[model samples]
Structures are given as structure tokens and as C-alpha cells.
Target: MSIEAGKPAGLRERKKLETRIALGWAAIRLTVERGFDAVRVEDIAAEAGVSPRTFNNYFSSKAEAVAARHLDRARMIAEELRARPASEPLWEAVANAVMARFGLTQETRGAGTSDQQWITGLRLMMTEPALQGEFMKAGALAEFELAAAVAERTGTDVERDLYPRLVAGAVWAAITVVTDHWLHADPPVAIVPLLRDALHQLAAGLPVP
Candidate 1:
């Protein structure tokens, strides 16, 4: 039978969401407590009160759980871009959307204790080979989503027009460079300013020397 239009999700959807969330949290908690390599999939599943097969349904690997929190940011930016004023320049639209989704500010800081844990998690992900690979995959997915958003905003065909993909790649590359530099900074540094600098560099369109 055909499903009803706009019907609220029934038992199955809620159960699935609960299961996914449990698995994600379990994976992240384990990874945070131990290094990524030290945490096993079976352990994560058990911690989440699910079977290994259920964990596999939600995430392919433990690395994905750590990165899951950031995945929604790309989709959020895409939605914001889609709603932006048409008069805004493409770069401005994208920049505003991206920053709105990820820009950190002092007002948002909580107990300083949590900040240290977040920084530690980031450092671990940066240093872990498996997690880095997963991070790259997540990045590629974000780029694809961004390209589609750009194409929609610019009235270009995402597949046939090369410009959308090119712009998306350039933007992703700029962010990647900034993030890599931040990870290796001797004294550590704030990401917001570095990301702002990267965005400005893109806006100025300076040729790479």
C-alpha cells in the first residue's frame, strides 16, 4: 500500500534513531577513553546495548562516530545557502553559511574543562591514521553536498558545469590547509581566526605562488 503523505514516523523510525544515537555515543565514549586503535567494534556495540550487526548498520567504523557531530554542519550550511538572498554573491553566501554553521565564539564557551576534552579529541583524530582516513571521506562527502548547494544558488547544473565542483574543491582545500596548520601549531591556536583568514584569502582570489 502507498504510504500516507507527511505522516509522523511510527515506532520503527524512533527505535532506529535511538539505536543509532546509542551506538554513536558508545563509540565516541570508548574512543575518548582509549585511543581509537584500542577500541574495538564489538566493545562499542556491547556498550551501546546492541549487537555488532546493529552497530554496523549505524556506522561502518568507530572513526565515523567521532566525526558524526560535524557531518550535519555541511548539510546545515547547504540549507542556509539555499535560503540566502539571491542578490548576495556566491562566495559571500557560502562564507556566511559556513561560518554560521561552524564559527566559534566566546559566548558559546562552557565550563573550560569540556574544551580541553574537545581539543584532546581533535588531536587524537589528527594523529590517528585510521581516523584521518575517515575524516577525509567525511570531507569529500561535505564537498559533494556543498557543490550541489552552490549549483542550486548559481543556477548551474551540478554535473555538467565544472565551476561548482571547482569552487567547492577550492573552498575545501582552503579549509583543509588551515586545519592542518592549526593541528601542527606549536602553541596551538584558535580555529576561528585561522578560518576567517582562509576565507578572506579565497575572496581575494590571489594566485598561488
Candidate 2:
């Protein structure tokens, strides 16, 4: 793993994490200010005070940098879910794990970046042909990692057990839809509550009155 195993990040790893984080924030801030097309790789690197080569080392494109936080959330939720007490119900475990990850994003709304900035950037991606495809590709890879974590928690084989894969996929899909709905709402909703509510609904078998 890039962060190493069973130990805190060493100096090198910490610096690398800082760099990637700086670059990601810079990329998002710039693109939010000037749209995706108007922003260049060199601009992201400059904003983060690095060379274009350094930016290339971290992310191949701007969209990947913008989406890095989303990818990290997927990894964090899976790891947290695996660490949740086995005595917890499956859906309960996933709900708590996801909520914890959602809290992480709160502090990261770094300077000059607001809900509107992120929403505008996301909306722009929908219309412009950008590196968002790469972002989705990264998200797909992260989904499988989440499935493996679920499998371990349940003592199920990822290769042989359909249950783990199905649950992981559905959970992520629900999160995506619910998150988009929250973002687009006129009075934006808090994601953590929405996430918890949605997971509870899924746990209840999607029942309606």
C-alpha cells in the first residue's frame, strides 16, 4: 500500500500525501474558478507550487486530481467497515462506516471552495468532455476493494460469494444517487444524514407505506 502497513506514515510518505492533497485542492479550486477547460495542468502545478512534472507524477489529469477525495473516501469507508465490530449488523456496519467517511469531507472544503464550487465543477464535467472518465475508472477499481473488505468482515469469498459483491455494489450505487440528489437540491441536504437514512432504508428492504 502507498501508505504502508500497520504503521504511521513515515516522513517520505507524509510528504507525498501532503503533495497529493495540495495538488488535489489546487486542481479543484482552479477548475471551480475557471472551468475545467480553461484550467491547465501547468496551472494546477503552479497553484500547488510544483512543476508540471510533479503534477504528472501524482495525477495524469485534472479530473483525477479533483476526484481524488472521492476515491480516498471509498478506501476509508471500506477499511472502517472492516474494522467495525463483527457483532454489528451488516447494514449498520456499512452505515456507520459511510457516515464516518462523510464527516471527513467537511473539513476539506478548503479556502475559496464552497458547496457551489464543487457543484459547479461537477455540473461542468457532465457537459464537457473531460478526464472524468478516468475518475470513474478509478472509482470502479475502488469499488472492488470495498467488496473485498466486506467479504473479509463476513468471512465470505469475494471470488465465490455473490452476496458480498452484490451488497457492495448496491451500497455504492445508492450513495452515488443520494449524494447527487443532495447536491442538486435547492436547499442542500447534509450528506451524512442522507447517507444513514438511505442505508437504513436499504436494510429495511426498501419498504414503502
Candidate 3:
């Protein structure tokens, strides 16, 4: 779909979104079943019903496919922030948007056997060297996107100075802290509250509690 100035997206964009979702799910399922290291790019492409070339068009590597979920979350938050009321404070808008986008639902909280597998995969991602590198790259891309959004919202000059970068770095740092905590938390508490709390602390210019 075309995203012209001040215009809504079109059918093409919606179709592209569907394709991306299919590929993302296919990749996640494969990784969960066979473990990340065991999954091959050709197998993932076949599973997603796409050519290896098409898979490469969507993602650079198999690790990227598995990390797509997290990248999508950041993209969702950026989109939400961009759509928020113009008059709202930037930090409040960003925090609220992040929570709305990533907040867990009842099903996710009560996820049974699948939850264990999902958590295991996430733990593997955190500890595996290859996955960690992929994760960092995805995170850096997300930070740049987020910084652009914040610059637009706050009327800060993104290219000319360090303010925008500083804002982006602080936001990303807060998110990293929350993610690290969530990874280690035994009972798998909801991340929304942790993220919101962290953002709130940042907004207040105080240490995270």
C-alpha cells in the first residue's frame, strides 16, 4: 500500500503485512520445534511456502526470522507513538504506546506447555552468540526508528545533534533492562508493567526503582 503524505495505507500494504506475518510464524514454529541452531534457511523458506530468495527478501538470515517478533514489537510501538495526539507529552505518549503494543493478554499469561518451550527458546536466544548478535542488530535498527519517531514528536533535530540519539539511547537502555529482568524472572511476569515503570522513572528523571 502507498503511504502518501497524510494518507492511509492501501490494499498492497495489507497484503505485504499478511505475507510477513506468515513468514514470521513459520520461522518461529520451525525454531521452536527444531531449535534455532538446527533449523536451516532452506527449510524455513520451504516451511513458509516461499522461495529461498523470497525469504532473503524479507530477512537476511534465519536468526533474523526468529527475532522478527521482537523487532515487530518495536515497530508497533513507533507506529503507535506516531499516531498519538500531537499535544501529548512525548514521554507519556511513547510509554503508553509501548504498553498498549506489547502488553500481555490472559492467554499469554496462562500459556501452558507451549509457554515453557517459548521461554526456553528466548533463553537460548539470549545466551547463544549468533542469536545475540542478530538480536543486537535488530535492536539497533529499532533504536534508529524509535529515535526518528521521537525526533518528529519532540521537534528535535535528529541529524544535526546528539539530543535525538540521547533520547533513543535512554529509551533503549530502559527497554534492555526490562528485557534482561524478564528473561531471568522465574514466574514470567508481564513485561508491560516493568516497561511502564521504567519509562515512568525515565520521564521523571529519576533512577529506575
User: Which ten residues in a row are the worst by lDDT in model 3?
Assistant: 104-113
Give per-residue lDDT, candidate 1, residue 78. Answer: 71
List candidate 1 stretches off by more than 4 Å: 1-30, 42-54, 103-117, 207-209
For model 3, how does the per-residue alpha-carbon lDDT over 86-166 read when each residue is reduced to its tens digit? 989888998888887874343422344365566676676577677778878888888877787788888887788687778
Candidate 2 per-residue C-alpha lDDT over 87-187 given as tens digits, one digit per residue, 9 for 90 to 100: 99998998888887765353555555677767766667545556567667767877787898889888999889998888888888888888777768787
- Report the C-alpha lDDT of model 1 over 118-193, residue by residue, as the tens digit: 5676578578887777777878887888888899888898899998898888878877887777766768788878
Per-prediction TM-score, please? 0.74, 0.87, 0.84
lDDT of 3 at 126: 71
The clash number for model 2 is 0
lDDT of 1: 0.73
Pairs of residues at least 3 apart in sequence or in different chains that clash in candidate 1: none
Q: Quote the positional error of residue 19 for candidate 3 in Å.
A: 1.5
TM-score: which candidate is best?
Answer: 2
Better candidate number, 1 or 2, judged by TM-score: 2
Ranked by lDDT, the better of candidates 1 and 2 is 2
Which residue runs does candidate 3 get wrong by more than 4 Å? Answer: 1-6, 46-49, 103-113
